[model samples]
Target: MDVRSSAVTIPAGNADLPADLLVPAEPVGVVLFAHGSGSSRHSPRNVAVAHALNEGGLGTVLVDLLTPDEDEVDSVTAELRFDIGLLAGRLAGIVDWLAAERPVGGAPIGLFGASTGAAAALVAAAQRPDLVHAVVSRGGRPDLAGAALGQVRAPTLLLVGDLDEEVIALNQQALGQLTAPAELRLIPGATHLFEEPGTLEQVAEAAAGWFHDHLHPQPARA
Candidate 1:
């Protein structure tokens, strides 16, 4: 499969966020990566997952949600990362930009988020019910999405590490609040980052499958 990779700048609100886009020939869909706080578009785990998604006929956009100046302040204050509303707004703007622009324009959209980014992704899905079709969260704080959990119409998959007990409980609580089609799967022996051997690969495989199933166009019912 021929794949084109490029660095693009996305305008979200007042920020010109940098992103890495990968599109294969005849992609089935495009998934946007929302990284955890302190992580950028270069997050190794997310990059790994994106690569897997690409091989499975999916396009991917790995974007930094914060500008350089904001990152500097966030690094020092550690407060911006927890600002779920701000992050969700920026993600929604990116979704709009992706829909209107480029090599993957008009492709079905999905979101893959990790850590706090998951909360942002959930809220963004709620904000754009018609555009976002699926969401996958990895070791995330979906509970942080608050009341938006009930508003997300997209099908959701929550991947939590079995070793990360606290997060699993939190995800369970959030899962109950979600009215959309959703499921919580546990990765054995993995911690918050899925740093255990072969655990991250499991996450990548599960995420790729979920997006493939949800993002594809269904056949017309007779």
Candidate 2:
């Protein structure tokens, strides 16, 4: 199955953010990614997971929340990373655009987020409950989602590395705060980035499985 890929640039708050879209010949669901702080859409780990999802018949969009100029500044200031409201607003705009332009037809939409990006994803999910079906956070800092945590209705999966003890505790707290059906899976032997050998594959599988479970097929008639 050859997947067709395209480069899309969406207007994000007066700037154009580059995105790479991968869709199967026949897509089953769509997973939009929110890259971690200091990590662009070019992050190899997220790209690898997106490839795996494409192979599993899912469509993927790896988008940069910040333009190159803003990213450069944030790379040093770390201010943009914590601006959950701003990032979430941009994500919601993209979601609305994709919903209008794509052939997804109310197909379940899932968010795959990493690091501080997870907080943005959560806020977007809370704001657009009608469109977002599920969410998966990979080594995410969901604690930054703030009060939005209690507003999320979509099923969510939080994956963290066992060796990332601090994050594991944070995710545990986020799990308790989430009003949605949610679970926390700690990948043994993995660190905050899941750089450990074979751990990323585990992250990919867990994400794909979570999307599969939460994105329901339109009601089937007997």
Best by TM-score: 1
RMSD of each: 2.4, 2.5
Question: Candidate 1, clashing residue pairs?
Answer: none
> Looking at candidate 1, what is the lDDT of residue 75?
96
- C-alpha TM-score for every candidate: 0.96, 0.94
Mark the regions of model 1 whose C-alpha exceeds 4 Å error after superposition: 218-222
Worst 10 residues of 1 by lDDT: 213-222
In the range 135-194, model 1's lDDT, one tens digit per residue, is: 999999999999999999999999999999999999999999999999999999999999
Which candidate leads the pack in lDDT? 1
lDDT by residue for model 2 over 159-213, one digit each (tens)?
Answer: 9999999999999999999999999998999999999899999999999999988
Instruction: Please give the lDDT score for candidate 1.
Output: 0.94
Whole-model lDDT values for every prediction: 0.94, 0.89
